[model samples]
Target: MPTGNTVSDGVGAFQSREQIILKDKKQLDCENAQDDDNDGHYKATHPTSYMDTMLHLFRGNIGSGLLAMGDAFRNGGIIFAPIMTAVLGVICVHAQHILLNCSEEMYRETKRPKPPGFADTVSLVFAHGPVKLRFLAPTMRAVVNAFLCITQLGFCCIYIVFIANNVKMIADQYGITIDLSIHMIFVIIPVLISCMIRNLKFLTPLSMIANVMMAVGVGVVLYEAAQDLPSIQERTFLASWQQLPLYFGTAIYAFEGIGLVLPLKNEMRKPELFQKPLGVLNVGMAVVGCIFISMGFLGYLKWGEDVAGSMTLNLPRGQILSSVVQALIALAMLFTYPLQFYVPMSITWPGLRKRFGPKALVAKELGYRAIMVMLTFVLAQSIPELGLFISIVGAVSSTTLALMFPPIIQLVHEGHRNRLTKYIVIKDCLILLLGALVFTTGTYESLSAIIKFFRKES
Candidate 1:
């Protein structure tokens, strides 16, 4: 959904390992002017500018999943959606800070060569905790990386369907109707080819193009969505209990960019600027929040129950601007797919690299990339219901990464530090409970909705 100023900062859910570490490899040896600071080693290599960091934060949090906020609103209500979005945005921001705080504690504790990746932080926290739980360290690390794969690949699946849906709409307008699955099949080859591009440098131009196109496309969508809106009094304040999970799933998916946080902060010149009030995280997320709320509010009031999975689809047909917007955004996502694929590939490749045992490593990596690309295409083709698929992924993978993991990590780490308190326990328990509720019910409802969609199609 989002592309950044830098390939590493902008392309997808998580930055490419190569992209993130390309500069940091020097940081391991170079010295910065943080003589009194704890993160002196890591912060020593501060090449990223503040404005660049803010842009990365904003772009990282906003993406193709953003367009679905309208359908999310349709599931909740006209009034309820915006309020919940603001609330969720605040929670997501808090979770990021919780994660940042945990990592800061670990940075001081471990005093390793460099900053820990998400997986490393989880492992180190659990491994150093109470002895009984130490054995779970590897498992927790695997779980975090596994969900990273699932979450990014899930976003790739979304991009495929999104691109196909946009293309199909254009074709349908020209009397060239085709099945959505068929459109996804067409996406597999190009996406597969794009994944072969291993150089992060090569992705920069693509990212730039994608960002510009998406900016224009979203502006047009907002413009069209704001037109001829109905009164708020006519819409429901809240939807039925069954639809609440769907809304939760969609909202989570829309707000999540958790994996990008640490890497972005670690890459910054002043990592301290990323935290607290008036910081980049707060300011950027506030902007992201307003945009999301506006998109949902206007798109819902403009289209009500009939809002498509992407509000872009609900734009007036037969208009050249509409077709151009669709095509442009579709192409933008096309450019972003490789960046998205790179994260999972980075995580999944390390295991595969160990498995290779020196049997033509490069060739094996390329082949593995192809299989994963096709895998996303196949998954998208199977369900092919963009809205429901977004919800399911949000409910399952995004919820795990965002809600379930952060609080538990904090609790475990706090216990290890003898800092655990009654209030912390209570608050963490509530977050975990909410995560569990959303994961179970949202997955069930979204899957049921997908089933019904297929039944109706048949």
Candidate 2:
């Protein structure tokens, strides 16, 4: 297998086609080395199984966003809710396929194996493109890294808001009226502690616990929602067209799991299974889309125009079941905060470590993580509109990462002259237009909603 030294040498000799092709066998060795080391986290012999990959994707996709689908449905109505959910699901899966295909082509041409992260993939794609485009490669990498950082930090902020809002709800039930910022401060300590964990594998048990809690909470929510289903005549069949932006934002946010796709695929023992017709990515996302559709339809049908930012908040308070569901969700978010925090930390630490030197690597990483958690807390407190914040981040950051980048990457990878390329280019261009529409309109609506909410509060 190719050692660390060979991998470094292969990347350095990226401009040499002859060298790369000659080193194809050695690059295969690098893949075997990566599989053995499992990205330096898992033991070489115990790589992730296909089932584990599916479960991880499912878990990653079904987080705080699932709880907001009911609110999204309230904006779009029953007619648009299920339809939009399915459409967004298909779009998300297609983008993931684009990334996978591009990565595979890059491997075949360069014999360098696939990049482990999104930013790396972007860098590699541009670096291997035409001579004129090579100079922009570093800039493209920076942009991807910036979006990844923003997307992950956005998730951390959402977790803080989610935890604070739920805790405030529970506290108000006991006649304790604490400020939301105070509740936010209360949650930050545990998040700070959790962020100190530097390894992803160490959090596997916590991830499993989070999955179970979320499953139970969602079940209770569905049961409560079903208990008070309104008649068909009482429900609106269609929402105003202006509200479509909000629906777009929320649906994209809820279904955007594109960030997790590459990482999971790269780690899989049977990496080839990730992109098949009925493979892990498609199956996992199908399940997630179904859950969102069901939750949004049933929850909106039950609560009509009164569904809160999260359906859990719409549940009857002071009841044991409602309290349990809320608390469980908070716990789930607490566990999830660290997982989300890890991504940005991983991205940021290398630069910091280079400056600070290797001796203080652990200290610098932990310190950086703690500061990031605090920053998220501060951001959460500033714009405490949980649903609107989610929509804004989804529109601006998640949509860019999940919807925009994949098509652009594919277009760049496949030049625009061939007959076969015509159809592919047309499809990708349409997807780009859709992403731009969502980013512009959804961002406006989300920001407008936040402004109106705060104006009323003030």
Q: Compared with the true structure, what per-residue lDDT tens digits does model 2 show for residues 1-458?
A: 00000001111111111111112223444654543333433232444787877666666667778888888898888887789779888988999898877766665556553443566566667888767787887788788778767777887888888888888888888889999989999999988998888876676567667667878988999888888577867877788877788888877877766656666676667777889999988888788789889989988899988887778888798887788899998887787677666656766776677798888778777777778888988899889987787788888887898889999888777762232377888999999999999999999988888889889999
Local accuracy of candidate 1 as per-residue lDDT tens digits, 1-458: 42211112254323423333222223532433343356345754545767877877777777776788888898998877888889888888888888888877887777655566677777778998889999999898889888877887888888898899999999999999888888888877788888899776788778778778888999999999888878888777799888889999988987777767777777877888889698888998899889889988888888888898888899889999999999998988898888877877776777678878787888988988888998888898887888898889899988888888899899999997899999899988988998899999999999989989989999
What is the TM-score (0 to 1) of candidate 2?
Answer: 0.88
Candidate 2's displacement at residue 407, Å, is: 0.8
- In model 2, the worst 10-residue window by lDDT is 1-10
Task: Supply the global lDDT for candidate 2.
Answer: 0.73
RMSD of 2: 7.8
* List of clashing residue pairs for candidate 2: 36-44
Q: What is every candidate's alpha-carbon RMSD to the true fold? A: 3.4, 7.8
State TM-scores per candidate.
0.93, 0.88
Candidate 1: residue 385 lDDT (0-100):
84
Report lDDT per candidate: 0.79, 0.73
